[model samples]
Each structure stands twice: as structure tokens, then as C-alpha cells.
Target: MSAQTPEAPTVTTEERPAKERKVPRVVILGGGYVGFYTALRLRRRLGKREAAIVVVDPRSYMTYQPFLPEAAAGALEPRHVVVSHRRELKGVDTLTGRVTEIRHADRTVTITPTEGQPYDITYDHLVVALGSVARTLPIPGLAEQAIGFKQVEEAIALRNDVLNKLDTAASTWDPEARRRLLTFTFVGGGFAGIEAIAEVEDMARAAVGYYDSISPEDLRFVMIEGSARILPELGDEMGGYALEQLRKRNIEVHLSTFLSSCVDGHVVTSTGVEFDSATIVWTAGVKANPVLNSSDLPLDKMGRLNALPTLQVAHEDGTVVEGAWTAGDCAAVPDLANPGSYCSPSAQHAVRQARHLGDNLGRFLRSAEPTSYEHKHVGTVASLGLGKGVAQVYGIKLRGWPAWFMHRTYHMAQMPTFNRKVRIVLDWTLALLFRRELVALGRLHDPRADFRDASAAPRPKGAQKPADKAPQSEKVATPAP
Candidate 1:
């Protein structure tokens, strides 16, 4: 004690207390829509060190989800859609961890990091920005075979898987095998499902030209929806036009139809039809993250936090949970604009709310009154395939390249950063110069040569090797666009 070791010195409770320090700490959860923008805006408004902003996310980057379909269709580069959380959030301390629970009673949150022991994070104020997850139903074989189109990795894997199917169809001479590989089904007629089906079908149709054997007609595209109509946002007129456009492409749109059962790669519909499909995409709907259920905050029917118009969370007693706030799809904030209708889960509302949430957080930090969040609905735009599309934006009906241009134009304007916008624009510009690509890069999944050796095993004079080996890119088939 007389001679303090220079190598390691002891710190007292005064230096670092079990309680929080004088720094005004703000803890924002999730790095998606609400989380990233909230952190970025807060950092901008709070000066250099007005408040200590900490962003906790399981991922280091915020994925701009709207561009996912384009990415899968090979229209946009995969990397451009993601905005780095650390790079964009300059002064905000970033922690890579999953928040297991938020103990509002103690003003503390427990986090489970990817590694190391779990730790507690204390915050003077908290922003719950945990985004929504794919809304899944208890459908048989769904969890095993069907892939969700919500995340980036899933989109990439789906693309590879789709291309893999085309290669399999091309390599095998068996009619049954070829039919199975070429048959693709999507469950959901929403914007995500429709766009995905359209783009994939278009891409496959284009690539079929490369294969002398395979024709575009060999590729089967089926869409099954439980609802009677598609693109609920565009209303009946545009919706009808969208359906007509898809039908014109030979896409089998089955309204009021869904997967009654899917065992292996075969799907049995409620209408008694059964078929084999190598690819099945589920983009039905979305729900709040289950992490919200772990928190003490009051939640709505779908497990979304009940947020006030001011963006603060309120208990049953109508009192704000002092430093707690929420926004985006996961928050059930009262819609002051409409009397009873709640906010729909869309990028449009989430983005606008994120800006407002950031402004509100800034106001609260400086003891200024926070602003209430309220925004009106803009229009909806959807791209069918190639230059074919349909959109009803602000009561204006558009189709063909006009709607397609509006789709790119609107999303480009809001595609996160100038850097990404440029890359996406460049992708589109190149598309103008060149034709749409439908080549399937299915071989990227496995790099091993043993399977190839096994498949190419020496055979008897008349006996044939079973066509069961994984697909390759070299067996490249002509695209179907």
C-alpha cells in the first residue's frame, strides 16, 4: 500500500461507481431503422459531448431492407444495401450485444454479447428500436424447407438456391427432375413476394437463352396467397393492373390459396393440388421482435411497445417511463393523425418516425420539450419485372417504365446514403446499357470436388449414375427473362 504498483493501480467506487456517472447516457437498442437513424440524428444534434450516446445491436451495420429483392435479383450489389453502424455513428459508442432484458425498475439493461460473460448496461435514457421479424405461422414443413425474404443473408442464399435449381434442371435429362428444379413457388402475394417472383422469373427467363436445351416455357412460376388480392396498398385499380401484368408473364397467381402441407420439396395446397418445387419463399408478414416481450414495458396485442405520441413509453397509468422512448414498426404509438387506426409497419413510417425520434431525443437531452410524431401516407410504387411495373403514387397511376422509374427514383432518394444511392443508380444505368442477367451462381455454396468425382464415377456399359449430386455453375443453362 505504501508503494503503489505502477503496473496496476486500484480504483475506488469514487472513480467508477456501481451507479451511473454524471455523463447523460442514452442507450438506443437495435441498429435497424429506428436504431441507426436515431443514433445518427442524436449524434448530430447533441454536439460532440453533450450526451453519451451508446448504440447496442446484434449486427454492426443497418441493412436497408427495401433493396433486398433487387439484391436477390442481381439488380443491386449486395454490399451497397447495408449501412455500417460504426462508420455512420461517429461519436456514439457501439456495443455488439443482444439485449436479454430491460429492467426499468433499476434503470438498467442486461445484454448477452456474442462472446464473454453477460454484462449490465446503465442508461439515463433508453430508446427501444428493436425492429420486426418475419411473421411466421405454424405451417408444416415451413420451418425446414421454406426460406424467409426478410434478411440479406436469406436473400443471397435464396438467389444462390434459385440459380442452383436452374443448373440442376439444365444438367439432368430426366423430364421429372427437370420439372422439379424449374418449378418455383412463393407463398404470399404482398409486395415482397410479388416483386421477388417477378424478378426471379424475369431473370430465369432471360438466362434460358444461354442453354440450347432449356426454354423459358420450361420454367414454372406459381404464386399462392391466402388473400384474394395483392398489393393492398395500391387499392383495386392498380392491384388489378399488377395482377394482369403478372398473369401476362404466365405467372400462376392463386388467390385464396395457401400451402396446406409441404413435405420435402412437394407442396400440397388446400385445393388438393400437389407439385414439386425446389424453391419456396415466405414473405407473408412481420411481427415485433420477441425481445420486447422480455422487457417490462407495456406492449400491444402483437407484442409492440405502447409508445406515446411524444415518442415516450407510457404505462397503464399514463405516465411516461421517465427516460424511455420507442418508434418504428415495433412501437404501438398512438396515431394522433387518425382517430383509431394504428401505424402500418412499413419503411415509410419507420423512416419518418426515426427522424422525429432523433429530434425528440435531442429535445429531451437539452431539457427542451419533445415533439409528437405524426406523418401522412405518401404513395406506393412497385416494380414487376424488366421495365414492366405499376404504381399509384399520390393518386397518380403509372405503369411500364414510368412506374419502374418511380420505383427506382423514390427508393433511390431514400436509400440511406449518397454512396449507396450512387451504387444503385450505377447498377440501374449499367442495366440500361446491358440486358438483365439471369445466370445462376449456385456452385458457390460448396467448393468441394469429391461430390463431382463421385458423380463422375465410372459406370457400367449401360447402367446410369443416379442424378443426385449437387449442382454446378458450369452446367449453365440459358436464362428465362
Candidate 2:
């Protein structure tokens, strides 16, 4: 050995020490608007090498909820309103699962996958943007019978259901049966209820033209609201304008009314209105996801995550919880623009908050302090069926066609990817040129019918299993025989 001391330092490439890969893990517990948008922005802010981002949602796609009404009306394709998370989230990991529990102390979340066994995922930071669910009442038959207007599936199902009812009403001979089939009741007066009711009403009215016996008059569209006013987002004047517009279309508007019962499609209202309606669409309201209790995170009285203006999860004493972030309907983020108030649970605020959160998260990861979230309320725009709408944009009130145009424009501008935007526009164009798809794909409801048929199919000679049956009775002889 030329130098014995050199032998101690000899090291092969395979034996050399490897560099440690230390990427912070971020776990987001929802694939809704806020969750998806935040992940999008976060990936842009921090590349894969910077952070390992994971999004968990029960559904593989994110629904553009604003266009749900249009989807129900058949104005836009249901597929166009949904963004596939797996395809869109290239840099981030998407999990089709639900966060059953969050152990904040250990910074771990228990994930229940759509398939396979549940597992625990540890994270350096966690975002609780699970969003809200349709709030239900104690009223009878509401859960069993009534349908919702939330997901794209719901929209498509509702569309087919409404069209199917029209078909049934047209064919049915009984007056009571016809009445029940034709009646459509919508609960709640917010944008969801109003837009859904209006759009579906338009579709139903158009569908009536195809039925020789059915007419628009036969289709009863009734809206029931517990509040005294509807479309409150458009302010008092515009809200009143929306109400008047809906009334002009002969859509019954019952205000300050609450649903007492919906037992077997017989809707009873607090205002003494009771009727048998085959269709009861509930857009009543949304409550924070009850899953918040699964974690040690602090929550408000309404069950929303207590979040600071910076969109960080906060303690009961209003202290920011480290490594925890939240936004959207689930987070009660303090409103910087409005002192002593929190951000309203709305899409606009959700998007803005997601942007702020993404920025803050980037800064925080880079060892910088997070900034506060602040945004002035622009206004609201609402569509009351085709060619009718109301809006208060930048303090300027608009009504009718102008408002409708603005509504379409604003939403088109905010409808996520350019791919969706183009597809939606093309759908609108095609709708203008061709007759709408009034045909109901009712089989979608029981899509397993084919499977059932297959299972009921006769088996091969040897594969058939004989059924156990009682002795058959003797048949009577025919008169001719």
C-alpha cells in the first residue's frame, strides 16, 4: 500500500452516502372548489421537489357547481361541468378516499379509500377544505324522496327525472296521477334554488312542446322559501327584480314559507299549502361537513373550522394553529374587509381565499411570515332561466337580458380551465343550433338493470341449478278441448 492511511478513506461509488430527500408533505382533505384550486395554485407556487402535495376526495373529479343549473337544464353537458382531478392535477397526488379522522397531535390523517384497506398518512401541513353538505330538516320523507342539486350526477339525474315525469304525465290517464307527475316543488330561495328551479322550468316548458297532451300550464313549478325574500345575493332591489321576473313566467313564488312535510311526495308547507308533487328538489341550504368533529381542530358554533384571516386554523383563543390551514365553506375565516365578521361561504370568496392560502403557504414554507387575506365584495349576478337575470356588479344594478349576459360572462371567465370554458361555449352554440336533448336517459338511475338481466340469464346445460318448488296444481281443461 502506497499509503496505509489512504486505505481508511477509500470509498466505492455504491458505498457512498446518498443525499436525503426532504420534501414537506401537504395533505388537503377535499377535492371541492377550494381544495382543487388551492392545490392548483400550490403546485404552481412550489414544484414537486419543493413539496409533496396530496389531495383526498371521495370523487375523482371536481364539479364546477355554478354550472350545475345549466347542466340540469341541458344547456351544458354534465361532463363539461366536471374536472377530472387525476388528469388535471399532474404534479400533485390525488387519492379517491375520505379522511375519516385527523389526529392533529401526530399530524396524521386516517384515509378510507374507495377500495382496499384504510391507511394513515402523515403530513407536515394539513388543509381542511372538506366543504359543506346539503343541510336537511327533520321533516318526514325528505331524505327518502327528495333529490338534491349539488353534484353533476344529481344535475343529470334531476334532468332525466323531470323529463321522465313529463313523459309519465303525458301518458297517465288519472287526473291525480297527472297532477302529481306535473308538479315540481323547489325548496330554498338562494341562488341554487332559484337558478335550478328557473333552468329546469325552462327545460320542462320546452319539453312540454313535444307532448301533444301536455302544455307549459300543466307543468307547475313552485318555489318555497323560509325567508321573506329570494336571491338576497342580488340585494333587495335586484332580488325583488328576480322575484318579479320568475313570477312573470308563472312560476309560483311562496315566500316566508317552510316545508312541513314531504311524506310520499305530498309536500306540506307551513303556509297551509299541501299538494302531491312527484318531484321535490331540495336546495335548502348547506351545513359544514359534520366530519369536523373527527379532528381536534377548533370549530365555531355552526361547526365550521375556526380560521384566522390568514386562512390558518386557529385556536379557541384565536391563536393560529401551526401547520394547519383551512378555507371554503368549512373554514370560518375572519373577514378583513368587514371588521368583526367572517367571510361568507361563497364561491368567489372560496377562490380568492384559495389564492391567498396558496401564497401564504408558499411564503410559510420558505421561512417567511404569512400575510392576511382581504378582498372587497364585488357583487352578485343571478340567472332566472334563459334570457332573464338580475345582477349588482360593482354597485351597478342590471336586470333582464343584460344581467343574464353578465351572469354568463362572469361565470365563463371563472369556470376553471380553458378546456371547460371552450366546451361550455360550444355546448351553448350547439344548443342554439339544434334541439335540446329532451329524451330522458332514465335507465341511468338503475344502471344495474343490464347486470341484473345478465345474472337472470339462463345458464348452460350443466351449469344450471334447479330451483326448489312446491308441487304444481292441475290445470283446468279448455272449453274447446
Which of the numbered candidates is closest to the native, going by highest TM-score? 2
Q: Write the per-residue lDDT of candidate 1 for residues 328-416, one digit (tens) a residue.
A: 88898777778687778888888889889999989987779988888777888888977878888778999989999898888889878
lDDT for 371 (candidate 2): 94
lDDT of 2 by residue, 133-202 (tens): 9999899999998999889999999999999998777755568989998899999999999999999999
Model 1 scores worst on lDDT over the 10 consecutive residues at 472-481
What's the true lDDT of residue 60 in model 1?
Answer: 91
| lDDT for residue 196 in candidate 2, whole number 0-100 | 97
Task: Please list the C-alpha lDDT of all candidates, in the order they appear.
Answer: 0.85, 0.89
Worst 10 residues of 2 by lDDT: 472-481
